[model samples]
Target: MISQTLTLELKQVLGALLFGSRRPISVADMRRVLLEVAEQNGDVGGRFAQTSA
Candidate 1:
């Protein structure tokens, strides 16, 4: 499991990456991207939840 601190960092990073994105990003897009990254390191949900907040 990833620490909350690290999760927050990734959330910030991913948010920044997505902020410059063009067009609308749907829920599936967010889920897929977060799951792909999270399942790899076991922290996707943490980052994803942060984004939702």
Candidate 2:
């Protein structure tokens, strides 16, 4: 299961992504961003790996 703090963090990141986007974001787009973030910083704390969309 995802921790509460991680859930909040994910929401914040996703919100920021959507706010900055020029068009509607897709699930595949979101997953790509999430995976990229996970690969780059290792700070998403494996949340994507732990849970499903």
TM-score of each: 0.45, 0.67
Compose the digit string of candidate 2's lDDT tens values, residues 1-53: 87564333677778888999999999889888877666665655466544458
| Model 2: CA > 4 A from native | 1-8, 43-45
Please write out the lDDT profile of model 1 over residues 5-43, one tens digit for every residue: 544356564685589678777766776666566556565
User: Clashing residue pairs in candidate 1, if any?
Assistant: 38-44
Candidate 2 clash pair list: none
Give the local distance difference test score of model 2.
Answer: 0.72
User: What lDDT is obtained when candidate 1 is compared to the true structure?
Assistant: 0.59
Clash totals in order: 1, 0
